[model samples]
Target: MAKLLFGSLAWFSFPSFADNKPLNSPVDYLSVLLSLVVVIALVFMLGYIMRRFNVTQQGGGQMKVVGSMALGTRERILVIQVGEEQHMLGVTAQNINHLAKLDSPLEVAQPSGDNFKDKLTQLMQGQKGKTHD
Candidate 1:
């Protein structure tokens, strides 16, 4: 009775204790191929959906700010304006700081005396202090 109970427990634990089969079987290979095809098809479908939604640009070449990085203890922000978007990345102290100042750029000054980048930074920092979205 003890041997029977132990055998029953062992069987329950080792459910896959059946015939030994090669992992690299034709069925497995076919399944892998099918999965790869499905993934590729899904990727194509996503691209199509993005195009339909206008999330991605249609034309090949558009003015895009490649990289913009900030540095220093002051967290002096460096922003790069692309076609219609801006990017803010992080930079090390070793990186050179080149301020691109456009003279007479703004026709009307901001009431807060801060540019777009400064306002964005302030907003982002404020978000860090509070939990509410």
Candidate 2:
């Protein structure tokens, strides 16, 4: 019985040993290093190009109209003033049809005020009165 048990255990251990060898080789390590270097070089090249061209100039200079009311209720058109110039943008289906088509960055500054909740409550009460009819 002891011999049979020993033989079975040895047979199961041989298959496991065959599969336990490491899968990666020296060439795999070299390939990974080469890829990392290539990616780093590409990123540096992109940074150099951006710095040389001055892409940041688009946001600061003279006023340019960059937004318009295209497709929304309440005539919600975005009007932006840059430096001195002003532009009237027609945000309609005839235009880019979406805000994403605008070329300039539009940021919404936070309003600094208290009593916003009171104003909201009043507006909600007014709306409730209208709906009751």
Candidate 3:
């Protein structure tokens, strides 16, 4: 009886040892790394193609920001023109509130690229920020 039990236990132990042998090889690890790189590259390529083609960008004519003011670091007020009508909006980090409907639209700044760069530099140098009337 003791011999039979010992034989059965030895048989089970051999199978468990075989199972513990590392199933993963260097080739399997390399294959997984290559697959991850391929997926990341495909995502970046798709993003570039979308930007280059300007996919899903609507032509601007329906609405535009007339003007804006910074009340605080995280708060702002903007006048937005929607078609023929204009609206005043109070903006915060969490929500936007309609403040009023303006009787007259605010004068919007139409700065050229170079002019805007210069203005930004001047503002950064601690000059009094120009207010658009």
Best by TM-score: 3
Query: Poorest 10 consecutive residues of model 2 by lDDT?
Result: 93-102
RMSD to the hidden true structure, all candidates: 17.0, 21.0, 21.3
Tell me the whole-model lDDT of each prediction, alpha carbons only. Answer: 0.53, 0.55, 0.74
Residue 70 shift from truth in candidate 1, angstroms: 38
Please identify which of the two predictions, 1 or 3, would achieve the higher TM-score against the true structure. Answer: 3
Sort every candidate by TM-score, greatest first. 3, 2, 1
Model 1 agreement with the true structure over 1-133: per-residue lDDT tens digits: 9878766756433222223344456666676577679879999999998755546332335543344333445454545444445444444555535455433332322257354556998899998999965
Task: Write one digit per residue (lDDT tens) for candidate 2, span 51-77.
Answer: 565344434455544544444643446
lDDT for 76 (candidate 3) = 94
TM-score of each model, in listed order: 0.27, 0.29, 0.40
Which pairs in model 1 have colliding backbones? none
Ten-residue region with minimum lDDT total, candidate 3: 11-20
